[model samples]
Target: MAEAAGCPLSVIVPALDEAAGIAATLEPLQVWRERGAEVLVVDGGSGDGTPEAAAPGADRVLGGARGRAPQMNAGAAAAGGRVLLFLHADTRPPEDGDRALLTALEGGRHWGRFDVRLTGASRLTLLGLVGAMMNLRSRLTGIATGDQALFVTRAAFRAVGGFPEQPLMEDIALSRLLKKHCGRPACLRERALTSSRRWEDRGILRTIGLMWALRLRYWLGADPAVLAARYHRG
Candidate 1:
């Protein structure tokens, strides 16, 4: 498919059994179209009708490989846009997110991510604290996660050899590669709203603690397979 004129940005959402939430996630892309952005949905062998759910809102929907990293790579390959956004199926971009991405792209920022926030009230305060910590950490270390809704120029993505086809920590791997290529990565003011399902399932405090431990282990060179087996959902 062709890209939008002037500003070429393609948002890719990877889905796996996301029929219930895919539409909500894609709704904001309708606004993005007005700001000269294209939306592509990559389905990871979803048993549910996720493709149909995203078809109406997305500019294109392509069947993807099983894993998220591979699926995102496939989506990026199909995309004709100069800027590629890697978004999760349970995340929603801010109202001005599209404009912010284009502005960053124009400003020579090859790689960046939006701030992240979680939905729901059970752990609102805790989640806010976590969000603040994440922002601070990104500023200090130049690491960005998938949940934050990362975006990068197609050239930069290709330079880093695209995302690794791993079952876990692919976001961290890509973020490190991006940081190596582009120092002091940009951070957009727009926030991506993410689902709190994991927090609810694992309990907020426990989940947060586990994430911190995982990060520490990763930093210490622990095997990602072990961490993935311990923390991965579904």
Candidate 2:
């Protein structure tokens, strides 16, 4: 499907202290540019030279407030495209993922995410299991996280008031809002590769348990700030 509107698509990446991973995250976009998409990287108080490393391939780089949500919103504000793709600094889309995203956007799926894969082979089985679970959940409930490389039309994003400027779970919050406004979400066939650093650090099962517990608490109407604090403390 091709967009009836002729405006370009913009891929926005929000980064923080991602010097080690930013280049890998951006390499796919360099190929996307050849297919006529714009790429923007928004840095949030990165002490490392992430901005510089990402600048060479990015169409524009903006420095912004130190939070992923705000940084993404800033990038969206600066974007000239009608379709906005919000990617994490540690995630990489597939080679033809931009085209696939455009197709989804044009097919009237205003907001959606790709399937996810964890990079590297260490503990690959465990990470793959988690990815399978997430895929199943997304297929059943249309809920996806940012690490899966979510995309939406600019109008849909603005209609949902953009991403909430929170310290944590901004992606989940935004996904909920999008589902409320858009009715149903969609998923691309291609998978986005995300770093397994967090799982590696916290242990996959332990982290998954903590995440489920936090989700249960949130569903029980726990305060976002409290949950964010707990996440930070962990």
TM-score against native, each model: 0.93, 0.93
Tens-digit lDDT track of model 1 for 51-73: 98889999999998888999999
Candidate 2, residues 1-234: lDDT per residue as tens digits?
234245468899999888887888888788788877889899988888989988887988899998888999998998878788899988889889878888877787888889888876333487888887887788788877888888888889989999999777888889999999896777887988888888889888888998888888877878878998887665
Query: What lDDT does candidate 1 reach at residue 64?
Result: 80
RMSD of 1: 2.1
Measured with C-alpha atoms, the lDDT of residue 59 in candidate 2 is 88
Candidate 1 least-lDDT 10 residues = 120-129
Q: Tell how far residue 125 is off in model 1, in angstroms.
A: 1.3
The local lDDT score (0 to 100) that residue 217 gets in candidate 2 is 85
Model 2, residue 198: displacement in angstroms? Answer: 0.4
lDDT of 2 at 13: 95
- TM-score of predicted structure 1: 0.93
Q: RMSD of each candidate? A: 2.1, 3.0
